[model samples]
Target: MERLHHHKVLTTVTWLLSIIISIYYTFEKPHDGVWPRRKIWHQNDKFHTAFRLNSIIASIYWIVLFVLQGGYIAHLFSGTVEHVNAACSVGSHFIVNNLFHFAFVMLFVRSYFGWAELFIILNFFNLSSLYFRHPGYARFIHTPVVSGPLAWTFIAIYWNGAIMVPHPDTLVARIFGNIFIWSILVYGLFFIVVYKDYTMGFNLSVLSAAIGVSQFLRQVVAFQWIFAFVIMAVLFVATLVVAVPAATGRDIKFARARAGDTERAPLLGEN
Candidate 1:
């Protein structure tokens, strides 16, 4: 019990500190000559590919994600058996994620794309391990807190790669960028189809919109934004279809008199 208390406290403090550092970097200069993150992103407009996300939309998405993270933190202290077990299972991940995020921000703003990519990759594996270790596959809170960041970072790998190489608005680079943009759709669909997770789909859709908006704003006569909008539409429709069950015109939970069998059986068996 004492150990659990310490773990929760550690995670909470790490979360708070990470958020503070992130906000500080967002608005203030990291040092004497370093520009704020937004400025760096804008100043490097030439380096941006078709995959670059809109800063404003991305900021809104981050705000929503962090809010969901706070909910996850509160769940840890709920003291219920399920909550406690969940905290014990994956609580350490929160701390690792915070640390990696802090490092990534620092490295990214300082123009250390290689090291920043390394941290993002490490964070990806950290979150992946947490997902596998915890039994809650697509549980409500777990989806956003765990899967959300995972999906974002998966896209970040590509986005960071593009910037690192300074994809100079060349035909070859633009062609590859257009082709690679759909990878986000593939990644989001895999989880939505396999795990019945809409949060991943929703998050990725928002990202796609951000990308589309950014591309359109930057290059109005390009195919990249069109592809992004198409991807967004497909993901949004898919998420809606998968999330809400069709009207079966019946309540199936108690359809069987002996629904609670000694050996568990799949719901709605073939008649």
Candidate 2:
């Protein structure tokens, strides 16, 4: 009776929360300040003659994310469907599935903007995934075992211009893009490995690296040498910063696991 009551309470809370979030995203003014109703972009363009493309892209991206995330939440709580493993499947149904959809959408939208930095921002999803994992939000996001590596690959491609713009000669923009992409990749590798899925991480990392190298080679041969070199340097530094801490943490976790196994083995042998 107690277990059944607990389950019912959990289900009720989940439904209520989902409904609330859905309503908020559907109607509320976005905190990120990119509302379609506002003419901020037009106003800026008229006065400054400088295009704030990143800001515009960021705004649109936020709207898409809000809608998709909201829809996924609604689907989970609709209660019109029944199946075994419904509880376990809820996370995958919305969060993970919608993520790929979201990525594909971003890919198309990014092509219009032609800004590598904007696409690089997509890497933050990995860090967001990791942070959410602590609260079991990973289950809610339906974040897959493959999300982290996939994110890294996306970042790599974005940086190398496979997924975003190759032009615009601004050092500051490139630097910001590099930092954002690298942070996500490093953070992603940590979470993916911690989840005990090294194979996926390794495979994705290698593939992304290969793509990055190939892109770099193409750029260099085409005489876009300065941008390619600078971007590569930024990528190398960012990778080191993000990967080092994650790798160290993984080593400690593995050591602890081995010790526990050794201790348990002796007890079992005595039995």
Candidate 3:
């Protein structure tokens, strides 16, 4: 009981600290006279590629992601036995994630792109570890808390790398960008097809659409935006076709197993 209580306390404290630090850096002016963290993309627009997401889309997505996290927080304190145990089981993972996330934001806002990329990459691995560790976590709780960030950070690896390199927008760069953009499609589908991770597929699809819109607004005649939009469509369709059926099958099997167990159990008189 003491251990569980400690886990809950630690998780809540870490989450609060992360939120405070992230909000302050992202929105408020710092003593260093640097632009607020949220403005980094606009301030560094010269380094942006066709993969950049629209600010509006990015804003809405984070808002929704935070809301989902809020739901998980509620679950952590729900007072139900199952909820408490679930929260404790995953508390450590969330603590590590929050620390890495805020640290990444700090480095990123300070223009330490190389170090920022390293932190984000580390967070990516952390999230992947969580995903494989708890593959059966309820989607409603797990999707936003884990899978959402995982998908974003997976693509962010490429996005951050691009900014860190700060290359010229040359013909070759655009050509390679167009080719590599499809890798996001492949990444999203692998999870959806192999693991039936619809949450990842959905999050990646939304992100891809956001990138497409941003790119289209940037260059109306570019191949990157068109390919991005296509990727979004494919990911969304793949989730519907692959994950939906697999989930339905799993639920059906679970119901049948429960029925079988009930039938095989001995009655009180027999015992």
Candidate 1 structure quality by residue, lDDT tens digits, 176-225:
99899989889889866765566678888998998899999988999999
User: Model 3 Cα displacement at 201 (Å)?
Assistant: 0.7
Q: What lDDT does candidate 3 reach at residue 226?
A: 97
RMSD per model, one decimal = 5.1, 13.1, 6.5
Provide the TM-score for each candidate, comma-separated: 0.84, 0.33, 0.84
Clashes of 2: 2
Pairs clashing in candidate 3?
Answer: none
lDDT of 3 by residue, 133-232 (tens): 6555655457766788898898777776766665636677778789989999999988876666777888999999888988898889899999999999
For candidate 2, the C-alpha RMSD (Å) to the true structure equals 13.1
Q: Model 1 off-target regions past 4 Å?
A: 32-46, 133-140, 246-271
Cα displacement (angstroms), candidate 2, residue 232, comes to 13
Judged by TM-score relative to the true structure, which candidate is superior, 2 or 3?
Answer: 3
Model 2: residues with Cα > 4 Å off, grouped in runs: 1-88, 91-131, 134-181, 192-194, 220-271
Worst 10 residues of 2 by lDDT: 262-271
